[model samples]
Target: MNNGKPAPYDARVITHYGVLGLGFFPQVYYYWYKWLDGRYVGTAARTVVKKLLLDQFVLTPPLLVVFYVSMSVMERKTDLFEECRNKLLPTFKTSCIFWLPAQALNFLWVPPAARVIYVGTCAFAWVNILCWIKRQDY
Candidate 1:
């Protein structure tokens, strides 16, 4: 097993990314629209940007941290920090890849009800990917 080290693929990169994708992609569109709308008012744009930054960068990370802790607890045992560090970058890349087009479709063309289509489709695939990852042995 490659000098007894866990190779990169040994971790579930796609699943990790998919999970993060749940939050990140949705917010991108949400905030982008908010920003566009807020620009009309002087301070509103700055306020919106600050709030978005806080929500996206500061708040969500802690939420994920909590989720990680809960996941470890619920499962009875696991290295949460290690998993977070190892999977973070891959997850970021995966979100970037999947989120771009999803957002494009959701924000640009789809009506309100149709927005759920992208979420449902992507979320389902992500859930399935995570399920598959859980089934595999490291």
Candidate 2:
């Protein structure tokens, strides 16, 4: 069923966001950031360190797991868990490499109001990757 076709188009498109949750993380990051750093001397320095490194490190692991698993299930893979296992590490490693600089720039420059849109916009490239990952024949 990983044929780039889903019984329903809505479900298919939304599934790319099964793990990513369209706007959820951005909202979470936006709100949750304030609570994290305890009275940092400089806001700019805190935003850079906290947003770039801490957020990514904490979210990446669980996000990868949900992404692989949800994607496999959404694609209707017969071996759902197997598909997740096969793709998890590879995709996660790639995401780590790819998102590091992207997030750094995001935190450094992009305004909080636009961060969700920023990450979601960046996720277009990731959508291509998801397309390829799900396209694999099992």
TM-score each candidate: 0.46, 0.65
Most accurate candidate by lDDT: 2
Q: Write the per-residue lDDT of candidate 2 for residues 11-96, one digit (tens) a residue.
A: 65565575466544555654554444332223486657765566567777776676667666666878768866777777767777
Segments in model 2 whose C-alpha atoms lie over 4 Å from true places: 1-47, 136-138
lDDT of 1 by residue, 1-138 (tens): 589876666345555545455655566545544554354223344544554454345544554455445445545566756555554445444544555555445445555444455555766675555444444443
Angstrom error of the Cα, residue 42, model 1: value is: 19
Scored against the true structure, residue 63 in model 2 reaches a CA lDDT of: 67
Candidates in order have lDDT scores of 0.50, 0.66
Q: Provide the global lDDT of candidate 2 against the true structure.
A: 0.66
TM-score of 2: 0.65
